[model samples]
Target chain A: MSDKLISLLSGIIFGIGLVISGMTNPEKVLSFLSISHSWSAEYKWDYSLIFVMGGAIITAAPFFYFLKNKEVSSLGLKISLPAKQDIDKKLVIGASLFGVGWGLVGFCPGPAISAIAVFDPIVLVFLVSMAVGVLVKQNIIK
Target chain B: MTDFTPYSALVGGIIIGLSVVFYFFTTGRLAGISGIFENAITNSVNRFSNLFFLLGLVVGPLLYYNVIAPKVSIAFNITDSYTLIILGGLLVGFGTRLGGGCTSGHGICGIGRLSTSSIIATVIFVTTGMLTVTILQQFGIYL
Candidate 1:
């Protein structure tokens, strides 16, 4: 099998996994983040988010440990693990903006893309806008 | 209705994580979404890496749903889909380019590869998510 084929398949599986895990649902995610307004009337702080994050970590932990000991390329590009650890203004500002955006929308790129399976116009719009954003930042803004 | 199972997530996550490992072992690659996507679209790198990465991502959920319990459902307001999606898209797109990767790249791949840059990027992504919620709530838009 070709690598491209495998990548595409993996992405599809990843999307399906997101859907099953309720990662695609912004409400569930938002509730997971802040229990104050979760639709679950009798909700305490939802630990589902922790589970999901933990799930993601557990899923990758072993391999990561193995890879940590080696020098390997990633996605066909040589991995460059940065040495300088500086939290500059750009990092802070960017992270702040990103958090605000995520909190408001309840969807990130990963889950949002998976939501395409729902065939909702809103998801379509989100994806288009996202692509346009990428285009602008990459081309127009540059 | 039983409460959610934290361990289920563990199982699912382990599967996904192992998939990432398998991806690396087989293709000698890291399963970073943005990087794989960038290469796929730009045709800048080997086409195989991009293909398998995307494939693993797509198929992962199907296997989980079929083999694992299928009670999980994604719940969200569909009414404001357009506005939310558009806003989300723009922000993510901009962030990915500015920070140089998405959550998967930094959070999953970068963290796995032990790259400081990936760690920084992941922090930015998480912080962004948190802040987005706070600001939206302040403006009464999060609802």
Candidate 2:
């Protein structure tokens, strides 16, 4: 129960951050991606997401470094770091596909959930489709 | 509307960082949203925890919406029809799992930890995303 509650709170913070940072808005994300164009208008180059992401990494990195030294977490949960260290085809292909999708819609999983916070037919469609996609991938791999 | 709110963005990010840090310290796991979502659906991870975490994501906005009902806005419509949205969703779904993480996983937690694979993955995704947008613009076409 404690674990569930903590993760729930964590999700809350994350969602709040996403919304406040404008990442949940497809338009803002679209502008950020538009930066790929050299002639994009100055206002169209939205780097606010960068500030949000950078702030997050800056604040979290030191604690993560501290966590690296310990076996159990500060709260006594077992350390669950990923064991996989390989860079293989799946990683590249999957990431590449994700990038394309994101450029197309600016709705990667995290912000897609953030998009849902506002309620839209399109966001729901994306969620259901993405879920189905994950299921498809799982079945194929196994 | 096109203006960027740097202060709010930065502060909100710090709050998010704090939450993720707490998540790691308490759960001993990185807060990779997509990974958790995938694991929950597949029954590959602690389904209850992941479910509740995702549930919290919904509840958080609901709570905030009580105070501020922000109108949803879109700057660029990627496509005129639902086809693009559907296609984007399919690719995201397959690619995130295939790639092993998403923005939150590889972009935030993975890069923070200095994981070589995460960094490489991030670079690839960002590059592809840039190329996708650039190419579409060049061709005056969008999918």
Candidate 3:
């Protein structure tokens, strides 16, 4: 099949998995990260978060295997991976900010967008600001 | 919604992993969150790849909620909504551009592929996450 067809199929499957797994629920995510959550209190120690992560790992196994044999792209061009390997100022500062936002809101951009499907206003604001931020960083500043 | 299943998490993770692999298979892309966003904005990489990758990110949850399960509750303090909207937006966007990717780019796709930049990036992401949580706690902010 064409690349677009494959991506659409992949996206549908992924969306179904997210809904089935309850990763869309920020409460579940927060409780999983914390030892003490009223939600977790009722729910048996659900480390399914790890499983979701693990599932992703398992799914990518084939890719790794392929990489082992074919480290370079098929087109005979060098893989354009990032070259800089330093823990520079940019990484430190940005990660700090991301972590703060993630901790406080229990919503990252991925899940935040999903929350929009649930009609959550908070997520809408997040989406708007995030889009604006992207614009500012790419366009206005540049 | 108290439909509890431990196996689902495993399945979910597997699905994510598979998606990453699929991403690479079709697009020759690494499935890095930051890279996807960058492509979306810059219009340099394949627009189709960016659209589909982002679509997966969004649809992943919708399918889970509507089809697989019935109810999902998320407890968020509306009082902090404004703060979250502004600061979180600026930080993540700035971080992604500056660091060249997000957690997925560094933590999952980057580390998995054994990229040095991803390794350093992951460390910074984790360390900053810890520090941010600590600072928030110190200020008597509970979320």
Candidate 4:
């Protein structure tokens, strides 16, 4: 089909996956990341993220590997993967910053976006702030 | 109340993996959320597709909540102060772009591709997030 339709389908699947995996639930995320909290909890740690990521990686990894080997995907289109693979200062620093944000809010972008359907006002604030942050990066920081 | 859902999460994860596979085979593009958001902001050639993808993220969950799992509300709560929430969003947004990808791009898609940078980024970020929580807990900080 069309590129937009394909992406939309992909996004829909991802959204449902986040909800089914409980990644859309802030409390689930908080517990997963809460080192001390997990120690006190009955479950030890919410390994849902591990399960989810493992599921995704196992199913997707081999497929992508084979696709990357080819100059083009099954659709006869060239695969576009990020070329930069260096572990530079920006990589570490930026990821650290993201981690801090994640730890603070119990959200990364995907979950944040999925949580939007919950109809919480706080989510709106977070979304606006995220957009602003991107704006700052493009306009002021760079 | 919340409970562990290891099996459901794994099921969801397989769907995620399949989605990535579909995106790759059909569109020939990595299904990175942050990259799509970035494209939307930068007015890239595929910005409209990015919008479509993101909109689907919202619509899909809405349909599931309303139709599939009405009993599962997945209560929304973050004890962090409003200031922290806003600040956290900004940091996540800027950081993901600067670092090249967020959890999905770097954590899942990046690692799947075996990109060294994604592997390193994933390790560093996850460790840092855990450390941040650990340190804050020690400091009697709630956020």
TM-score of the first chain alone, every candidate: 0.78, 0.90, 0.69, 0.90
Q: What would the per-residue lDDT of candidate 4 be over residues B1-143, giving only the tens digit for each residue?
A: 25678999999899888888888888788888888887877777888889999998898899888998888766677755798789889999988888888989988898898888998998888887788767766877654
Q: A24-141, model 3: which lDDT tens digit per residue?
A: 6655554444433324465454455556655665567557666745545543434455565577676666666666555555555556655666776777777677767666667754
**Top-scoring candidate (TM-score):** 4
Write down the TM-score of model 1's second chain.
0.76
**What lDDT is reached at residue A103 by model 3?**
54
lDDT of 3 by residue, B1-143 (tens): 23346786777667767767765665566666656666776686567856776776666666655655557543233325588557876677666666667655666676676667766766665555546545654676545
Candidate with top lDDT is 4
Off by over 4 Å in 1: A35-43, A69-91, A140-142, B1-5, B47-81
In angstroms, the error of model 3 at B4 is 10
Q: What TM-score against the true fold does each predicted structure earn?
A: 0.77, 0.91, 0.77, 0.93
Compute the interface RMSD for each candidate structure: 3.7, 2.2, 3.9, 1.6
Per-residue lDDT tens digits for candidate 1, residues B15-102, read: 5565566666556666656556555665656766665555555455555555554674435454374666667667766666556566
Better of 1 and 2 by DockQ: 2
Classify candidate 3 by CAPRI docking class: acceptable
Candidate order by decreasing lDDT: 4, 2, 3, 1
Candidate 4: residue A35 Cα off by (Å) = 1.7
Which candidate model has the greater lDDT, 1 or 4? 4
Best by DockQ: 4
Q: What is the TM-score of chain A in candidate 2?
A: 0.90
RMSD in angstroms, all models?
4.2, 2.6, 4.3, 2.0
